[model samples]
Target: MARPSMDTDTRPTRLYSALRNIKWEYLVAGISGGVVSTLVLHPLDLVKIRFQVNEGYGVTNRPKYNGIVHALRSIARSDGFVGLYQGVTPNIWGAGMSWGLYFFFYNSIKTKLNEGDSKRNLGPGYHIMAATGAGFTTLVLTNPIWVTKTRLCLQYDKPAVSTSSVHYKGMLDALFKIYKFEGIRGLYKGFVPGVFGISHGALQFMAYEEMKTLYNTYRNQPIDTRLGSAEYVVFAALSKMFAATTTYPYQVLRSRIQDQHRDYGNIRDIVRQIFKYEGIRGLYKGLGIYLWHVTPNICIVFLLYEYITNWKSNRPDNHS
Candidate 1:
């Protein structure tokens, strides 16, 4: 038999083609947006986590929060101004890694689903699938970081530390300590609720993409047309609110499961305790604070992503 033609032998495999078509700009923009947003709003994030884990079980050691204002002032007065940013290190790392990987994987999967043409319009179902895949991947990679961040934030800077309370000097120390003490299971304490939380991202992205597509269609532009900052802000905020409102309960569950102060048997046990003691409102404990923290966060991330991608696409060298 004759040897295969040079063209046939040199043809790139499907995997190679897909890998080569991967647009790295999305990852860069996402990492940049995530780091910047976290730096700006980490205090609110700390407050949100604190609120979520506070179940009013009469834990004398931890500080009590009446509301967002009280929580901010109380944390500041007790732990000083620096205390508000207790989990900044791990939060930044987790946010940056998560957003970067999420956008990369989401766009990559979307491209694959569209048969290598990323500009092709995908339905809401396809968008959800892409976002879900990205969210799951990002969660697996960053769950340990989030667990460390939660523990770090929950460490109060009081004069008398509770015997049950675990103090971590920093992110690495916390990770090491958790693994040393509780093993891999400790790092993934809230993994089940976290899996459910993927719906948050999936819904947000699906709504976001649909809104953008509709807006562009209304304007008689291509589906993938670049949008203005205001447009991005509106779409991002709306989509984030939609997702956060629907999935806020799972967040409370995740925080409670990961909380160092309380150890429930499992997710169901936690749910039962919250329901029995706190009722339906307990499941949405920190929703107000969460909205305050996350709405601006999504806006910033989307704005940065859009602007950065637009600039990259318009670059002279990129055109060449």
Candidate 2:
């Protein structure tokens, strides 16, 4: 039996051959990983966003959440277990689509850059460049979903009264309201910070790729050989932690900018206010929870993505 020839830029792609061969596995794996991870860590994500936006204006306002424990308890007592999973609909949509697009672009770009070298790791530089491309592309396309998700998660038992028409009933309603009232600009509020935050993925993918390469080299294994699930978890956790910490402040700013309950003037104004009112500690409001939430979530996603992609790749004549 003959092996399938690798697709290269030089070769003319015959119809959906490239699509059938290389793309579907990534799409399935990425979307599946993203949805599963979001469901598991959504409560913690809600808590993190709440804490991020809880700091207020006047001295009298104080902060709504003192810490993670207070925030979690407050949410559970007030909104019940269901409240913790608020915005999950859009959250799932955003996460799944973002990751799906991310992996597609990541693998696509990486393949293009690799030319025909199907046998070597692309190293850190190529990995960074490819990841940056994927991050920027995925984030821009999915920002609207994220905006809607943020608004939903920020909701409390008492609905926020926006001069803008109606309150959000669900994902579709939120998107419609945001469009009707805030316009396209409203849906892209956090775009600048989000663009800046793209480095998180770039840095993360670079680190993850490098770590995996090192791990493989250390084990004297080939690049195509699958690592144990535990190894995947460790590499993913480390990469996610690095990305989250480095880009965390942007997460706070993004939440506030998207919060229907609060209004922050501008990035500088928001930065100044948080620094003045809540101090340095305020900038890192829910980082502990974020790290806790993201580490295992990424671990799950990475493990599943790698395994699924590998399984499909190794299967005979398994085109999409």
Candidate 3:
């Protein structure tokens, strides 16, 4: 007369197992670092997005920016001091959630690969594997948020004449309108290019981890040995520079695909138009601003991540 409740009982056990496996310290540190860095550096990001979508024409009603200083001055002039932070709401949420999930997944994958041996050096291959998995997971989950951010950053006070020209009051409004008008595909507009951009994170993390491993080995210290903030900054900067320069074109492509003012048939169409009109350099629009934006962003993220993790590990209660 009674059906087995085994499935119900096992569900909670499985949930508990998953929760137990997560390293909460990594998640907290990652969210904190990402939110803080984005808060301090969002203007550069806004400028970068504007430049990325501008294809040498008046694509939107936004003011033209001749250079970094000019762009800042022009935005402030047109939209006032608050103009600089157009898409910061979605940007902060995206950054925090993305980084937190990335670190959580990355460490989980690495732990699985290590097979409970924390002292084992998994090397660069394992690092790459973990980072790639984490990047893919994070990208898919957060692509919609990024699409919303791009659109919001690209929004102007004055609307363009195109019927396709749209505006968002805020992050929630953008998501709802995009979904209502364009369906799920609209919310994931840049997802294809974002998939390629996964390499950016994978390469950055792999390089960062490798440098830390090598430094510890050279110092004859444990692989987990904590380093000073200055050391973390140097390593993060180098790794980010390498990754950013190598993988920047995808960012331009993603921004262009996500641009509300212009529409392209496909990635190939976008690439062909960009190449035909702007040449190879078209693919690297805003790279200088990107470099300026990301260098310090990575430094702060990695430094805080390391510091937070170290602090957690050193806590007396954490010693068992």
For model 1, name the residue pairs that clash.
none
lDDT of 1 by residue, 101-156 (tens): 99999988998899877478989999999999999999999999999999888887
**lDDT score for candidate 3 against the true structure:** 0.90
Candidate 2 lDDT over residue span 1-320, tens digit each:
96666765436666566656576778888999999999998988888887777776542332388777887788788778887798999999999999889998999899888885656789899999999999999988999999999988866645463343357989999999899998999999898889888889999999998998888888898875677889888989998998889888888888888887666787888889888888988888778888988988998889879988889655878754
Please provide, for model 3 over 130-202, each residue's C-alpha lDDT reduced to its tens digit, 9 standing for 90 to 100: 9989999999899999989998998876555434446688999999999999999998998999889888988
Task: Report every candidate's CA lDDT.
Answer: 0.90, 0.84, 0.90
RMSD of model 3 against the true structure: 2.7
Using Cα atoms with residue i matched to residue i, what is each candidate's TM-score against the true structure?
Answer: 0.92, 0.88, 0.92
Model 2 whole-model lDDT (C-alpha atoms): 0.84
> Considering lDDT, which of the candidate structures 1 and 2 is the better prediction for this target?
1
RMSD of each: 2.9, 5.9, 2.7
